[model samples]
Target: KEFTYLIFPLLCFFYDKNTRRKEKNKRHCFLSVPRWVSLSLSMCLSQTLNRSKMNHIPIPITCQNDTEMSSRDIDYTVNALEVERILNYHFKNKRLVEDALTHSSYTDSVSYERLEFLGDSALGLVLSIYLFLTYPNLDPGQLSLLRASNISTEKLARVAIRHGLYRFVRHNASTALDDKVREFAEAVSQEDDPLIHGGTVKAPKILADIVESLAAAIYVDVDFDLQRLWVIFRGLLEPIVTLEDLQQQPQPVTMLFELCQKNGKQVDIKHWKNGSKYIASVYVDGNFIASGSSEQKEIAKLNVAKLSLHKLSDSRPTKMEGLENTGELDGKSEIEGAKQKLHELCRKKKWPKPSYNIKDEGPSHEKKFECSVQIVTADSMLSMTGDEKSRVKDAENSAASLMIHLLQESDYL
Candidate 1:
């Protein structure tokens, strides 16, 4: 009778447990559990079955989620479709792309931080491989520099802006971000040099994060295929900086130092901060030659260097003639009064007067404007648009400056 009672209770317990397992499987079919949890459970179940001497019978283990889409995921899917269109590549898992574009500020969802971390390493590795294979003649140092420049935060940020990838990012409304993005965009639009490290404004890291996170999203979507990642990114990062570009346009600071060294003059740069602005002064042989200011210390230094180069070159035109002729020296000073310069150039060439189109955007209190210049030709339309600025004139000048630089570089000035 005691043996019968024990068997009855054991049978009831097994029946209840099996019923619960089946119900659980029905409710959760997504199987989103971590790998370690699945492994641990499998081991425990195996040991229990072995001890119980029921190894002949099979026990099923499953963990899953409901197939119905969550409201949040549905919203993400819409955005994901737009992003996929921009990337020209569809995603097998839309959630990955959604997570990539989401900033940490957006609560209750996965952020791009983890994906950015993965992408940082993956991007570096892929770029290193490309550099290694593409330029077999380049030494390690040269290759390292190329890799670093190509994968730099500034470069990636530029790529994000150039490709309009920033528009898809999901983040909380941030005034600081808006201002930074606006300033950087303006700087980029005004800049005509592709090989330059960055434009007048410092690039925001958020932009770079978006790019890296997107790269990781693609990498994961392609099953961690580095080759596939490269194929997608190669086109996104257009106008890749080449060895010739690097050699032709060295860093402004480096160029200035070399110029001074050749002339037996000591180059000294001093930096300080005034309010939100960082100021840099260029001193040659203990005499202050020129000064420049920016929101970034490095950019301020570079600005002063370029300004000093202009001053030095003008002071000894004959000595710097060779450098200027070879296009090593920046003709950046000509960009000043760029509107007038463009008008004069058009008048001189007997081309139609450059036409301007202005756009005003943002809140009234913090309004921004952008300008685009177009010069219609018989066979083509040459146009340039500047980054948004606080003033319409500044925006117009920025656009004109870019156009002027392009013309000068093409030997049409």
Candidate 2:
């Protein structure tokens, strides 16, 4: 009798389980349980089957959503299709597109969190490859800066706004987000300078994420085809910053450091907190050049650098009279003139002689030499390269002349 009662309970348990499974399958709802819960249930069922000497059957968990789409979901699908059109590529799995556009705040079936993670890495790789091939002469540091400027939040957000990608993002953020989007759109429309390398504008991160997630979605849809992904996105990321652009107006901090190093001045950046704002001061050769304050230390530093640059420009002498007065340019060849001026400046500053590195290229009969002059200041090393010349001495002289001209322009001489 007791055994019969045990069998009855087991039958009831199986019948309830079967009923629930049928209902779930009919509704087409995914069964998402915690990992711990699933493991605990599996172990308990295995133990029970072992005790009864019966074969253990594994339970199948469905990860797909089989349920009917709500009105909102249908709208999301339509919007996603429009996004696909904007992207100029179709997804074999449409769910990937939907997931990419859905933000965590939406509380939908799934968000773009996973895809965003994947997209971040993919975007970095694509940009790295693009910059590396496009700028063959750029060093690793220059390549990094170029990549960072392109993939920055402001730049990516600008991309999203330009391509209408932000319209398809399924987010439930506050009105502030909408306001920010509108403001950003307006800012972009009125922007005379589109480059975000100066860090003057504030961009919403979600807009950037949308761009990245979509990139990831396309990558996955194409089965991780990086070349195809670049082809599609290269146009979307228009006005690609080139090496010339970076050199024309390098980052303020970089410009300041280079100027200080070339002028044999030491640059020191000091930071402090003033209530809620952060303050940064730039010191050149023990003198306080300029100070700036902002909520962010980086911005503050940039501002200080800009101010210092202005100060240096205003204080610079207009003529090369100092070089003439040094008695280094008396009846000498142009090459000797350049070398003597550089040596005199180094001696005045009590610094070591500048180093010259020369390289010869081409055949023996048509050989060309390239020279680079490296000046070691107290705090930094400033290097400048000159054009190729037929003679090594000419190349070195060209480098030295270039250095002197630069120093004069920056008011160092």
Candidate 3:
């Protein structure tokens, strides 16, 4: 009877009302069950019920139409429409606009990747043609540099921020991205120059991709007409880098190398990677001049070279009028004497020992050592780099001598 009672509940839970009713009717015709059987059935039914509840699976929620969308999706759609208004050109296929702004993180649907690729090629071609026509006399090298500056990632990102295109980018990335975009926008706002590259600030790549994808979308919508695409986008890429700008601000490495060569000196660049970042050190005539760190190896090298060039310019002799000729002071004895004097001065002043950073450049047969020295005193700190030396000790001595001369001239000795 107990087992029968337990089984009854199990049957009720498993079967629908009609099925349970039919089964109950059929059970009534059977002989009465024992109480133990009823109890056992009830226990089994309860266990089954608990197990079912524990194992319940939830149905995924999906939106079939705009009415079913959450407030966030609605806002996203509205912003997409506003983008068209901002551009003042409606996308014939509205999906293209959405595709341009849709980052890979946003949805599994089409993303900006394809469009970005297309836009990259289109942008390069357009810039090449524009530059070729604008500067007929400019060589291929100059034209290439000019085009690169005008349509670079930094330049496009700047354009996106200036025109408020980033706000429309549909990305599902973390709030960190929002913060980065905000920071980049603020940085651009503070910048005075309109045509910016990566020199002053680093621009986010996503912002640049959005601009390129949009350009590609425009090209596709206009039946792959390059002229039509240019007509729409030429003004958007304002303050194009001209030949004059390139001449005024040649690449840092180029400028530095040229300056060194003109003065009958050699420039060397050495770099190493630290995790994901790169550290670059510049040596002018075998002397450690400056160092820079960046996420990119090329950028780091450029920065180090630029700093070295600036230091060289600042240290150039202003008036060679009354100073002792110090003609070709590259001998071993002269360097040793200068190093001894620098050490004595530091000891007399009770200053900490001066430190030197040295680097070697060139082949084994023609190795050159560059050294940088920093001397910190009670009143001030002095840093100087010496001309390159054939030996490490000589480089150190040369650096010490340069610092001593600079200190005496500055009246700090």
Off by over 4 Å in 3: 1-77, 270-281, 291-298, 310-413
In candidate 1, stretches whose alpha carbon ends up further than 4 angstroms from where it belongs are: 1-68, 190-195, 267-413
Provide the RMSD of all predictions against the true structure, rounded to 1 decimal.
12.5, 16.6, 23.0
What residue runs in model 2 are displaced by over 4 Å at the alpha carbon?
1-68, 270-281, 286-413
Q: Rank the candidates by lDDT, best first.
A: 1, 2, 3
Report lDDT (CA) for all predictions: 0.72, 0.71, 0.70
State which candidate, 1 or 2, has the greater lDDT: 1
Candidate 1 lands at a TM-score of 0.56
Write one digit per residue (lDDT tens) for candidate 1, span 45-88.
44455445444554232222335567877766777888888788
For model 3, how does the per-residue alpha-carbon lDDT over 1-413 read when each residue is reduced to its tens digit? 55465457556644445676766763552335554454455444544544455474331211133345566655566776887776666765566787889999988457899999999999999888877888889889878778878887778988898789987887789998888888778656643345333533467889989999999888776656688888888877886777766554456577677667767898889999999899999887788999998887766876687578657755766321123244433342334577767877987887655645566789979989888775545543456778898976688778888777666666675
> What does candidate 2's lDDT look like per residue over 310-379, in tens digits?
6675466633334444644344334566866786787687554565556677997998988876564444
Worst lDDT run of 10 residues, candidate 3, spans 57-66
TM-score for each candidate, following the candidate numbering: 0.56, 0.54, 0.55
